[model samples]
Target: MFNPSQFHETVQRINTKVPDVQHKASQIDIASVKLANEWFIPEPVARLIIWLKDELIKLVEELMNMMTQVMEGIEAPITMWEDAYKWETVRGIATSVAADVNPSSLGSTGQWTGDAATAYTNAIGPQSTAAAQLATIADSTASSLRSCAEAGLAFYIAVALVVAQFIAAEITAAAGDASVVAAPAGLAAGLAAAATAVGVFVGLVAAIGTLIGTEASQVSTLHGLAVDSTAFPSGRWPVATNI
Candidate 1:
């Protein structure tokens, strides 16, 4: 389950990582500047440097934008579910109530059947069953909320992985041998390959209930979960014991 507390900690770590990535991007820019001043760089090599630098910075900017949506649409809702709704607490209370009026707790010893005991059992039996049903509902609702949070986290992770792939490609191109002029073409190819893999993986994640997807059905699912709260009204039916 995706605990809101753990997600908060994970988001803090991700926040720290953003600054580190920004710093690395700045260093890349500085290195490119120094190389331009010192070396007899060919046109192709200089263009490659500029292209890779721009692409890296673009990925970082996109990541930041995605983080905003993640916090608003994903983390916020999960936190609300954890704090405001308190489904797990409700489940605990219901479970305890369901178990409290059992034969053992009601002082019904072995073969000790009396009028009072029978009357108590008759009164409590349906209530216990109803409480158990409510407990199950609460547990499932909590699980669903966690699943939504996890789905959003997965999309955010997919974006981060794409950024990492770009960084790796940039570093490789900058540090390679004399055939570095061909780096731009290789990097473009690398970008296409990385996009393909991430696209497929993200598509699967969206299919399994996530916020990232290109298809219509997946997008609809994302909208329903993240945006359309009215579509999923909680506690629609009144609570009542099975009579």
Candidate 2:
């Protein structure tokens, strides 16, 4: 007998998980923007970076819902099957978005894994043409993510350089002023500006790195859920395998 209390608890847990996921996703977008502004990335590229981060976060949420269905054992095989279908649907959308961003790297290997990979492979069959197609899409998405990160870094560096130049000019101008004392004020101001630029640059870089790590972890979690949700030898059975 499925305990209603248990089901409620599970739902609550999922709810809790979602906000954390959303927070991280938002952080990724903010970081991307900061980095882009620093590096002077074009408006279009910055917007695209935000879009990619949001989309990935959305996909993760969908995957989590599907996983919950599998855990709840709502209707045994049929419900479980539906859950798998939903996962595939979300993946399809992700892949489509990735293809739109970068097609050449479509289906490149080693970028995604776990539930997404398994669901995709199962949907198209491991050796089928469809699987190959999905692989390409996954590869493209990963590559696009990497490209976005690089663009962010470049933007940050460019801004830092500009700020540094401005500070240098200010210092030189102050040096020629008769009223300007040889005290440490000018030097201190210059140092402060440079320090601020370095701090911003480092923060952006860290954010990009964190986003990548989070994505990888989420992929792994999804995969593990997909694998553990069903009983293998029984062939896609979702009756709480342990019971």
Candidate 3:
């Protein structure tokens, strides 16, 4: 019952929405790279920047694929429900006949008799269980996608800060070069400045890494909450048929 056309449409919808988020994140990465370049970082840092950008692009593609699968999983149950509902209608009619033919028999116990009861039970119980399981799968998939995205972002941020530090070091080196023509006392000052810059850069990098780790922790928590919120109760299962 799952229409291929509908699945394709849903995948297209997800793909269309993902680009906007990826673009925004990419812009942030570009800005960071520009800032690093302005500070005169070494060539190695620029290479690293390029690597980070490529990784981010890959993450975006993976996210789109994961989302498409999730969307398809979500759609599958609806199609199954539609088919189940049609079958339930026939079951309902048979139940009515069974009830009329055997008033005292358990088979005549209203709609609970015959195929109607079995169909209803299957729809409300097993079908709902399957949906919940699918939701869990989707949730897990989304979580993995988010993890990859966050890791890529964190790597970018760390590399940017390191590049900034390298740039600062280069500036210190330039100052040291100038001090050679100034005074002997200026030599010590230049050395001290470079050391201070290195220390500050190391500390900043450590702090940023810690922050990124914290953000990653929240990703799983958020995903679990999303799954719990979306989990539907079995009672809400649509009537498979009429009685």
Candidate 4:
């Protein structure tokens, strides 16, 4: 079940983290640029220093790009909060209404007879069915939203790994000649990590799409029921025919 309180708490937690993440990314980007600009290389080592500096700066830029994607993922749940609440509220109302109109709730009209009793029985059945259908719609919508929120959080975690790789590349660049031999290996590791994260994020996005489609189909069914119910004078549905 999607608990609204839990969702709100998660959003609040992410809200507190946004500024810190952005600040760290910005600082790294600026520092990398400064190091690239100020490093002095003698003629003998100029080629190596220039190449390393350019590579470091490039890695820093990619770090910022990864940070951007992570931040977007973090923000997704906050934006979705409204929609989640809407569905949750609908679910609560529908469930309550369904219970109210159910046979057990309405009870038997054993003491009554004629058109009045017949009408009550017929109306209760269809009304209960329609209310149950509405509840199902809400449940489906909530489930889809839950999947999306979970996926977005997972995506952020995955991309953060990619960002860490760039940071490692920057550290290796700053280590100077003693670590120069390790630079290629560090860069390769960073690229490999990025590929893995992007692949996972793509898969998560596709799964979210499928969940949304299912939610839409459930909602469409409820809409159809509402339209069909319009024919009855009582305006209740799945129609009274089942009665």
Which portions of model 3 show Cα errors greater than 4 Å?
1-113, 116-120, 140-155, 178-197, 204-243
lDDT of 3 by residue, 107-130 (tens): 424557577666555544433443
lDDT of candidate 2 at residue 220, scale 0 to 100: 59
Candidate 4: regions farther than 4 A off: 1-45, 78-86, 177-243
| Superposed Cα deviation of residue 193, candidate 1 (Å) | 8.3
> RMSD to the native, candidate 3?
16.6
Reference-based TM-score, model 4: 0.60
Q: Backbone clashes in each candidate structure, one number apiece?
A: 0, 9, 2, 0
Score residue 185 of candidate 4 by CA lDDT: 49
- Model 2, 1-243: lDDT tens digits are 223344444445544543454454344445544544545456665555445444444543543454354335323323323344454565676455445434234374346678765554443322233233444434444444444434433433343343344334334323322122321233334334434544554454466557657655656544443344222223232232122
The CA lDDT of each predicted structure is: 0.55, 0.42, 0.44, 0.55
lDDT tens per residue, model 4, 97-160: 8898787676566666898788877667666777777777677777666666655555445444
Best candidate per TM-score, number? 4
- Ten contiguous residues with the weakest lDDT in model 3: 179-188
At residue 242, candidate 4 shows an lDDT of: 42
Greater-TM-score candidate between 1 and 4: 4
- Model 3's alpha-carbon lDDT is 0.44
Worst 10 residues of 2 by lDDT: 175-184
